[model samples]
Target: MKKNGEMAVRRPDDMHLHVRQGELMKVVVPQTAAVFKRAIIMPNILPPVTSAERLERYRERVVAAAGSASGFEPLMTFKIIPGLSPDVVQELKQAGALAGKLYPEGATTNSEDGVSDVQTIYPVLEEMQRNDIVLSIHGEDPDVFSLDREEAFLPTLRQFSRDFPDLRIVLEHLSSAAAVQAVAELPNVWGTITLHHLELTLDDLLGGELQPHYFCKPIVKRPSDRAAIQRAALSGSPKYFFGSDSAPHPVDRKHAPTARAGIFSAPVAYQGLLRFFGEHDALERIEGFTAVYGADFYGVPKNGDELVVRRQDWTAPDEVGGLVPYHAGEVFPYTVIPGWK
Candidate 1:
């Protein structure tokens, strides 16, 4: 329990979460399920989930993992491809997909199946727009604009918005100031801020000693960019919300000779956010960023379920399921008090 007046709000959804398949899924799903009432599961997996059929199978696996965990049915999304017909979109909507994900080719982990040509996907995008479907984008260029991918991709995304004004678009994990500004200026664009990106920068991760933990795609930028994102997240704007982007890779992969790309914060997500907010003296806005904004933007009903974060501290397990490492170490100052048994 908290020392005095301290209390936790309800558990929040992870707008972005990656639970890999088979064994890894079995190992990781429970950790996230214990905290988040629902999560928008990423489709980038081995043989990425691009079809309705595959999405169902994945959903089944997730449901099975939820088992007796009440209020823990994590929602899944289809990473739609150009090859998928409009009818397919309608079919998946009928199947209960919360949204669809769009990844530009080779942008991040397991993204080879992503769209190679955005133009080719226009028909599918149009279909989604008509159906009131949301398109969650990876938001980066495939090549050339490496360092400035977010800026480079804006023109294309702007055109997409113009072509499909009604489509609900979410730009996943906005890293740079330019990205945040673009999302802020665009009417249809909602943006997510990842926990890792919220905390560190590219130079902090790679420049001095190669701190692999700070490495993430659309890689972190200058301090000025960080400041901008901090402002946007705290601004209480409905268009911006919290997404841990809690991707997990085996400790071997993260600490390897060639470290892999991802961060696993599922275990300590809420506490970390609380610490970050409290340090900034922005605790009151925590609910806006973590729960209200995300639920409102996604059209998900507010989960009446409440969770408390006691002042008592806890540390994330160094290794969960004997693979993925907890982001940083387990030095959190809060614990989620779940509503359900």
Candidate 2:
């Protein structure tokens, strides 16, 4: 993959990404489109994309924002709410939804309407299993302490694997070693590792200063957790793959008294990942981690085109599309060669 100071790999598919609705979406969608050929769009926007009509409309808006030339595919998902009709699952599949996101109530931003009890959505999960629709969960138990939430939710995850044995579940943005091991042990279950989680720790978020932007739901964990996640990603296991979780919030909202939980990583993700994989001597395996495994798991075709990165220094943008990006102002040794397919 690497030769003559350049690396080439399949254009990645971001398995988990959040491009919010309306004006904000317009600003961020293209950043992801630039580096990723497709992205699984999150559905937890205000009012949420719960119905078929809403999902179609949201997909349309995302496509429009991505524009005709980006060749970006927004793999849409619907929000999973309690009491959801099983019949509605068929409609969502017909509506082109590839998955359903389960956000525990009050777990993250705009998730106040999420499912509180895991069992309450069993009917919906049953339908999805029969229909082969993927179940993407936020994977945090809201009642627990911030650091313990992900660990606390493992029991529920285990129960789901036992109850709905055939369901394809994605435990999103894993932050701990325990979670990494749990996902590895479960069959038909996969985990998405965020760039922030791979590169950061609780220390990066709070051990220095109040880094509100680094603050995220299932907040980044200890150094050992980061190591475990890094090990998993580098281990070449098909069960773990890349998902930027590139959430963008307005500057004011991120800097406010109650700062939001997200990191706008789309702009920096690919380049940072190139450096990380290369430095770790795992450059050859990056293609599968970013572009192959997730698509294969979803039963989609891998991207035929390639994305190139040059061994060139570039500074990470301080602010992108009015939102702060991950590793802002840091100089990266590798940079994506823009507009080169």
Candidate 3:
């Protein structure tokens, strides 16, 4: 083992993450910044980031909130909805958007304003294709049962892939075997696997007493689903990489009546993931998954920066910014020494 069990790699990026807005963002952005060089900030805020101007404003808020955290950057994305103009899509690209995220109507948090029919946003998607903006997908059919939602939405991705052969589409936070296969086997398509989805299953949420924190949109699936995801993560597939999809919710909201659907994994994202990859003996691929591939897919330059991981074991902070983080109160085998500026 390296002295003090320390290893380093090109600094990674959280390809998909949610830092909410206002005060919550202040509380959570640093946790991610502590480990990642950049992250794709989800735009499903209260009103949602639909326009380039709004996206810029949100980016500014996020940049300021992150506050001189070394070289950390927040790559922004816009929420797609019906009737979005091609002109608006161009404006978003000009505003430095890495992609445009699609949330099916009523599918997840603040998605009531999302697309009811995928076709409704074809104009925007077409424009994105022409302009080279990646299309990030929330691959779940709201009408399907919670467990089956992600798989149910696969056909739509297939159709869209065929319809827009040149469009770059990323299936966000895949949660099922079917979804893993779709992204693994499909053409011109890619998928992001979340830490929670890869590690937790329905049983983790309901096996003993109700573990409310385990609940999330497209709720964790079967052990088979998790195993399949693990295979993909460890398979050394170039198409698959890291994206934490670390969505956070306030402790009150997470533990309350009807709870919310998200996991605040930012704080433990690095250490937890390092532990996971280590357990599988797939640690060699960590840098490619966390730092290289997503940047390659997004057409951005890989960060020249690097993150050093110490073999030291540490317990993750129980709460970050007043909200309970994923793996809260749990110990992990590794901790990041966060070197980049």
Candidate 4:
């Protein structure tokens, strides 16, 4: 509750997050674990977590990185590939996979192995549906123009909704007004609004000097799209929830001739969301967007602890884990108070 210049919110759960392996994971996991009680870890690293064995091992690494002090729970997921058997789906469920990520081949980073013909994985999808595992899609058609990719994928998403009537599908990182509206209209379908997508437009990426840091797959779209995302996030709709999609890349990779598509927002996700919601005069709804709704959608309980942010200004770090962070160097209206009881 807001009183005397402090707002206490339920400890959030980042429904979408990417903590890369080894050194990078060590550098970024704490930033998220410090604030979010739990996070759905993305399975798109090199030699992606495609099997139950890999998922278990990756989850261990994430847990080891997060440590016990913060009590961070890494909810694991498997990568969906062609010819994955129904037996493997059961194996993953037994291995603690909360979801499975579907990336259209050539769609994004390390996705060279992603599904080329989504229909080829129908058996796997049907198995996931039976096992009650959520399907998280990167909602873009590789054959379409960059701007039209997400909208172009709408038909496929609609098809999924029809085919797997009971399957819970999350249109990861919603990038357009049409996508946002589709998720709202479809039953058992929800959309994740990333920290970068909620505020960025194509202009932010290339309207003037090219800002490579804002470059991401399903690239941020028009201002109208941004407005629609903001409306969905602020509307306190359970169908739309927070998923930082906080993918991190080294500075050199981001600035390379072929820059990667990701924004390392885990470090500033909570602070940025607090400032955004406060500015919108919807501070009370922040809990649902950041913490409650996502957990409810996953059939998990809300975090019992509260994270208190004070009306104190703090500038975001210019670089986090050797990557430029979202809103780097910009001042935020609120900052998290360490060790909230």
Candidate 5:
């Protein structure tokens, strides 16, 4: 941080993000590349990216959408669905997938094809463990109550820690206190906490007349849970870092009779974080959470260049890509130097 209140830090990675296909991809992917040097692009598309071939095609679309944005790397991933051979795990690694996402069947949008039996994928997990690819788990059990979903998945994470002792795993967008403690105790496990989860609580979503933009899978838990996550994030623990999970759905789908589950924060995630961290006196911790830990966890080199964030006000647009972003219309107290995409 400079005397001018403009801080330059290494360009970061949105370790977990989703930019849906075709036109939507064109609209949103740039929002991420504009700020971060790299992003781990999620694979849960309409016909989810399940193979190296599909991943390659998706990468081309993402690259084209990114359009010569220098060094804006789209680190691709594959969805782990039923009947996917373990042999294909090696191919995914060779194809440059940083991780394989495990979404329990019926967990979230486009996850109907998610694996039902973790046992069925033991061979794949073993191969991933040997190959050193990270396993990104959705960390929810749909059969359980919404708020209890993440807690219920703790045992599964524990089992992975015990069985695949060498496999690196990331518990995505952890929303509960139990999850925070669970990840802390596990040696090979790391957690990615979203900007929305660190800021919003179940109260913000339902305490009033129901703010649909605050809704998301593994729905925001109690305030105590939010505090626990906040502690883990700002405490500067390398075990927990940022992954926006910046999912976007059209505005009609967001505020309809039944709203979709997601919070599109890519457009304002860094600015929002800048404000939140500054308010909490954790400004110095920002780069580590957003940039360093994730790349280190994935065995990639940290981004060399830097981005300057100044203490300037920039209000996010209410609508982006026909979608309502989380915290829509609110004024952020900080601004990225290069400005919004």
Candidate 6:
């Protein structure tokens, strides 16, 4: 439904996003739902969406939020906790929840309720394997490697794949060379790279200019590590896909003395990628990263909806709906011209 010759492209899915809950959800959900046909919603809510009943309620709320927006009907996928029993996994799968999300405790915001030990949830893993359910991992061991958790976590996750060959595992927002290599080598393992990590490096963190917005769990790595991630994302491997991991925090929270870490890139994610691709002369390969690869990796159907990325210039809001805003006052080179039916 886009204008002719406008560089329209199929709608993209956000494999990872945190739309928060309640008031914050009301403000931010529309921006993402407008662009992405579906998203793997994060489970790190205030109380944590750990039970089937809570997940159902959360899904209802998300649906209600979407209902208020015309032409926007984004699918909400529930992220399961690792503590659920095997029976619970079967029940949720039968009822059509998308997949499970495993957050190692203390890994990031609101993740205190996440699984403290992976071994403690073996029963749930068994059920997920039996039910053909996908398990999305945060990919860090809370205790062992503070700054280098990805290096410490990949081996355990690789072992899990070996133990449960049938279970689909997605390593979310992978920021290390080891993670990229593990996903490439493992048959059932898939990995997602976020736009923030794809573009920045540790020096950015150390310099403290971008600071909070650039900070995130399994924190950004050295420049060489980022180069490895960039290579893997452009590698055209089916298992390497895109996930914005577009977490938004209020401007006040972001600019505070103890600012929260997250980047709200949903509104401009594709444009950012397109610019990167265009500069790299990989514009033609954008489809692999934006649409095809993620669907194939997750076994979800490609979205029938389409959008356009025009060459028009636009500035991202300093604040949208009273949220602090992502890249708060920066300008970008492209815009996502949406035309959802």
Model 5 CA RMSD to the hidden true structure, in angstroms: 1.5
Question: What residue runs in model 5 are displaced by over 4 Å at the alpha carbon?
Answer: 339-341
Cα lDDT for residue 29, candidate 2: 96
Residues 1-341, candidate 3: write the lDDT tens digits: 37658787788899999989978888888888877889999989988898988998999888888788456788999988777777888889989998999999999888988788787788888899999999999989999788889988988999999999999999988889999999977789998888888899998999989888788887998999999988888887878888888888878888887898888888888787789899988788888888888999998899988777888888988777688888889999887774653
Worst 10-residue lDDT window for candidate 1 reads 332-341
* lDDT digits (tens) for residues 119-175 of candidate 4: 799999999999999999999998989999999999999999999999999999999
lDDT of 6: 0.76
State the weakest 10-residue window (summed lDDT) of model 5: 332-341
Clashes of each: 0, 0, 2, 0, 0, 1
lDDT of 6 by residue, 1-341 (tens): 13542566778777888888888888888877777777777767867665677777787777777555534443334445555666767667655666778877777787767787678888888888887778888888878765678888877898899989989998999898888889889999999988878888887876666577777777888888788889888877778888988888877887788978788887667777877776776766777887888877667788787777776676777777877554666666667775564
lDDT of 1: 0.80
Estimate the overall C-alpha local distance difference test score of candidate 4.
0.91
Query: What's the C-alpha lDDT at position 290 in model 6?
Result: 76
Measured with C-alpha atoms, the lDDT of residue 187 in candidate 1 is: 88
Overall local distance difference test of candidate 5: 0.89
Ranking by lDDT: 2, 4, 5, 3, 1, 6
TM-score of each: 0.94, 0.98, 0.97, 0.98, 0.97, 0.92
> Which pairs clash in model 5?
none
**Higher lDDT: candidate 1 or 4?**
4
Which portions of model 1 show Cα errors greater than 4 Å?
Answer: 1-5, 324-326, 338-341
Tens digits of per-residue lDDT for model 1, 1-341: 24584575866788998888888788778878887888888888877776788889998898787666555767778886657676788888877777889888888887877788888888888888887888898888868566788777888878877888788899999988888988888888899998777888778887799876677787888888888888888887888999888887877788788887787777777778888887787887888888788888888887777777677677767677776554546677766665542
lDDT of each residue in 1-341, candidate 2, tens digit only:
55688877799999999999888998999999988999999998888898999999999999999998889999999999877788899999999999999999999999888899787889999999999999999999989898899999999999999999999999999999999999999997899999999999898899989999899988999899999999999999999999999998999999999888899999999888888998998888899899999999888999987877888898998888778888899999888888646
lDDT of 1 at 295: 89
